[model samples]
Target: MKNTVLITGSSTGFGAAAANYFAAKGWNVIASMRDTSKDKQLNKQENIFVTHLDVEDTASIDAAITAGLARFGKIDVVINNAGYGLFGIFESFTKEAIQQQFAVNLFGAMDVAKAILPHFRAQQSGVLINVSSGAGVVGFPNASIYNASKFALEGWSEGLRYELAAIGIKVRIVEPGGATQTDFLQRVWGEGKNASIIPDYIPFLQKSEEMYANLGANSDEDAVEKIVAALYAAATADDDQLRYAPTSDIQPLLNVRRSSSEEEFNSFTNGLFLGK
Candidate 1:
């Protein structure tokens, strides 16, 4: 039987890349996005289904799954890839913005998992892949809320893996971050521009920018293509691994965090953003 993978936020970047990659591999692709019109060519591919899905809306989530199942009898994998970064000073974050960040990054993912697990439970086999970021573990400068959301996701996935494993469902988290040119980063830049910046925080924010430009995220030899490989690895692996830091600088940076003493780590992290 052919495998069907349902991916959220498939209109662009990693999600869009993944949709095409999986389809090319002959897997049935359910490319769900808030605006399906964004990629008119996505549905044109063979063995692909394009559908409207707003991660924040439970009704849309349910409908997308229903439509996907109707088109492809079974969904073998679900990639919770619908999320964005809201970066800037914490004090500048409006209440609405903070809530929206968690709503899409944490709660929306949980809701999607909840909606899909019943099917996986019945089938006794499925993969639930969450596309997390380096922010999941490392707190980037001026990205407190973004860091918080990804950290919550990391913790949630760790806790959920065992329960899902018991039902033959494999939960995997793919961590990738540190690229500045992707549509994701562009969105972050645009969103941050509108945030009401406090004068006192301006210097700190500039330092953060310097940190990112000079000593920012770790880079792998490969590019975004590594993400597709990582997703494929998670979806196809028949092992007990729960976390993957493929194609991003997360793994090496994680090494730095693990090898350093608490004080040393603190000094190192602060140095990037504080220069102290």
Candidate 2:
């Protein structure tokens, strides 16, 4: 029997890429997204089942898992890849906006993992691949909330791995730098209820944007492909290998964080972003 994998946010970006890659590798793919109606291409592929799964909604999460099991008999892996970016100064975010960001990025992924644990336990073998970001490792300007969400995910996955290892379940994190082809930036939500920018922060925001644009232009062009490879590595790697950094550009930053002192790391990162 082929191993089956269910991926959230599979309608686009790295999720969609992973679905296609796994299906091509002969694994049964559950290509899940929030809206199944928008799935016009992935569903047509053999061994790929496109379904609705809104990670923020527990009912939808359960329904999607049930549907996958019914179709594939057993799920071997669950990829938590559904999330969006909330960008701007921390003060610009309302309580509701902050809550919503956490709801989709952090809490939503946790809910999916929690929902699938029983099934994984029953099977005695399963992998949970949480799609994190480089921001999870190193903070970036104008993305404080996004960084926080990913950082939380990293910490959660690290602790959960130890707890789940004895039960034959594995937890891994894959961090991707920046993908050029995705609509990720276009989908990013701005500050607060009205999505308005604070006048005082505009100049700083523009500088940050310009810097990010330059960095992105210099980043690896095939980020999605690299991320898919990282996902595959995480799924199939040794149980002890918990973190996979897929992009070259981010590796140096992560290395700096790992090898430098707190003050040194902060100085380096601040220089990169704030031009200090």
Instruction: Tell me the lDDT of model 2 at 59.
Output: 99
For model 2, state the Cα shift of residue 260 in Å.
0.6
Lowest-sum lDDT 10-residue window in model 1: 181-190
- Using Cα atoms with residue i matched to residue i, what is each candidate's TM-score against the true structure? 0.93, 0.94
lDDT of 2 at 124: 95
- Judged by lDDT, which candidate is best? 2
TM-score of 1: 0.93
Candidate 2 clash pair list:
none
Candidate 2, residues 1-276, lDDT tens digits: the string is 999999999988898889999998999999999988877789998899999999989999999999999999999999999998777688767888888888998999999999999999998999999999988988888788889999999999999999999899999999888723233233233523525555787777667766777677768878789999989888877658988998886888889988999999989978887889
Mind giving the per-residue lDDT tens digits that candidate 1 earns over 189-242? 445554774678666655556566554345555657898889988999989898
Report the C-alpha displacement of residue 230, candidate 1, in angstroms.
0.2
What local lDDT score does residue 137 receive in model 1, on the 0 to 100 scale?
79
